[model samples]
Target: MQFVQQIPGLLLLVTLLCCDSIRAQDSSNMANMTSMMANATNMTANATSPTNVTNATMVESPMPAQMPMNMTQPQQQQPSIWTTEELVTDLSLPGAPNATLDVRYNDSLQVTLGNKLTPLQASTAPTVCLRNVSVGCEPPFALLMVDPDATSRQNPQFRSWLHWIVVNVNSTEKLHEGDQAVPYNGPAPPKGSGPHRYVFLLYCQRGRRLQGSELAPEKRKNFNLAEFVNKTELGPPLAGNFFFAENP
Candidate 1:
């Protein structure tokens, strides 16, 4: 009886040992399967997520069509006042007569004359003659004459008149008898008269003589008109400025 009881006990112990071994083997297999599943999930996530490289490149690059053009800055312009070159070019009128005179003081003055006159005329009595003078009288320091053709005729009531006349001019100064003066003469178009040219002339000379002395002694003695110009080097009898307008 005792031997049989011992055999049963031994068989029970062997069975328990076999069950423990099987349980351990099953736990190891489960752990291996779980690790394999985690690896597979990581690979799937990597494939689905957006790549950092391509996205970064897209953000940095600009579309060629959207680019702007490089532009240059604008330049500033100069004012319209007369320049020495322009003044000289305008003063050299074609067919203008050359007078016997020397320009002193400023070359700019010569340029001023050149820019203001029309073509020259050949008459001893300049196309624009000095008024109230006789044969022996000397030319004023600066004289100007204008042809009506060069003036504006915008207003009928406001006629163009002599603009400037510089007196006591140096006789050494010469002008193309028909050139215009600073104080140019305007066309005294008769009422209802057709348009007429006003001549302008410029002269330069030395010393101021009374308008009286500038005239022929015989003429000065005969005409008792008030002196048009004084001995001072002020200017001509009329205002020394020019403008254009139509006869009223």
Candidate 2:
């Protein structure tokens, strides 16, 4: 009929130009999704600002300095002084009938005896002497004579006799017959004179006592083996003195 009524008005003008190009591509994809959600809400408000959180805790970085802790060391030294002069020479004479007496002493005869000589006995033996040398008191004692009945004298010149004399003995106290004054005497040696040599002498004191005269005519002389034999000019009597003997 007139080209079939102009083909239904050119198929209703190509279906209204494909519904206005699908509403202009859905309004250009909803304006590019609202400009990418406004650039992700302005980069999440510049990372929670506060000047980027105080420049991340003021440019952080600092901590270092600590060294010196160690110390302990010191101790050593001891010895000032100690001596009993060999326990006072082993407590003055300890054994051996004082073995061949020579009781050594240096600072000029510093004797030390009395460990226990029965304490200078008298009725039983001690009383040897030569104290103040003699005086009105009759103190010129001299008796040390080891007897065994004076060695069975048949006139061995009446054998040993010296018996009890004693004289001033305090020399720093040591003669002990347990001292009530002095009393213990044992070894009466002259029976055969085989063992007799007792000597106990200890004296030291630079000065003192020597008045003489106790029957003084040079003190009734008698003990002479050539002028009172020498043992280093035996002296010291004014204050400190000691003597004891037992010869056979």
Candidate 3:
């Protein structure tokens, strides 16, 4: 016990050295902790940054392929007025004309599908452009203008009164030169009758010509268009246009 007591000075010196070394080691550990915390803060900031996030998103997912021109793009179609109206049934058309039938009167009044007109306004013959109106008619065309609504739209007693008919026409400039099945007659709706629908049809004759003679007055009344179309060997109508007329 006396020998251990004699070594107390050496033990005190060792304790002081040990404490300084521990302080040094603790300071070093604190500095390392601060450095690690700063590194962690920088990593979090970069992860949240827009540029890094965008870069990460780009790396994770590739771009999609561009759409082809023929896919769904070419499926879009132009609108047609004939297809919108009930006259498609009377005309016995397979489809509305790809090229519209444009009818223009002398007064610059136009008939487009189901527009209204007075008996006097449509008294004179109109200028009808059939087939591809933007270009012109190439094939021989047969035109038939008739009143399915003869007396009134409801009654239709005197049904399908033939107004005009021209067959084997190529040019729009001279419809008179074409074979006239029936001379042009102005619309005559009976007084008190509400309105009458006059339909004009154009059938493509292709290369063949129809030598239709001038129709008798009796043949004008009850003129069966569908039967005439079948008898004449004309297929579905190429184009059609109609307008309403009635007595005031």
Best by TM-score: 3
The C-alpha RMSD in Å for every predicted model, in order, reads 16.8, 22.1, 8.0
Clashing residue pairs, backbone N/CA/C < 3 A, model 2: 118-177, 119-176, 119-177, 121-126, 121-183, 121-184, 143-162, 208-238, 209-238
Stretches > 4 Å off in candidate 1: 1-59, 63-143, 150-187, 193-241
Cand. 2 Cα-lDDT: 0.34
Considering lDDT, which of the candidate structures 1 and 2 is the better prediction for this target?
1
Give lDDT tens digits, candidate 2, residues 1-248.
99999999999989999999999999999999999999889878877888877686665567666555664455664321111212112112222221112222222332233221221232243322223332222222221222212343233243323322233333322222111312224445443444332234333212322222231223211322112213323232222112232333
Clashes of each: 46, 9, 0
Scanning candidate 2 in windows of ten residues, the lowest lDDT window is 79-88
Q: Give the winner by lDDT.
A: 3
TM-scores, in order shown? 0.22, 0.19, 0.61
TM value for model 1: 0.22
Can you tell me which runs of candidate 2 are displaced by over 4 Å?
1-12, 48-50, 55-248
lDDT of 1 by residue, 1-248 (tens): 89997998999999999999999999999999999999999988776678844454445566567545776577786532223223212323222323312222222222223323222221112222333333243555545433322223333232223334444454322332222223322234445443433323343343434352233223211121112223334232221112222243
What is the RMSD, in Å, between candidate 1 and the native fold over all Cα? 16.8
lDDT of 1 at 209: 45
Which residue pairs show backbone clashes in model 3? Answer: none
Whole-model Cα lDDT of every candidate shown, in order? 0.37, 0.34, 0.76
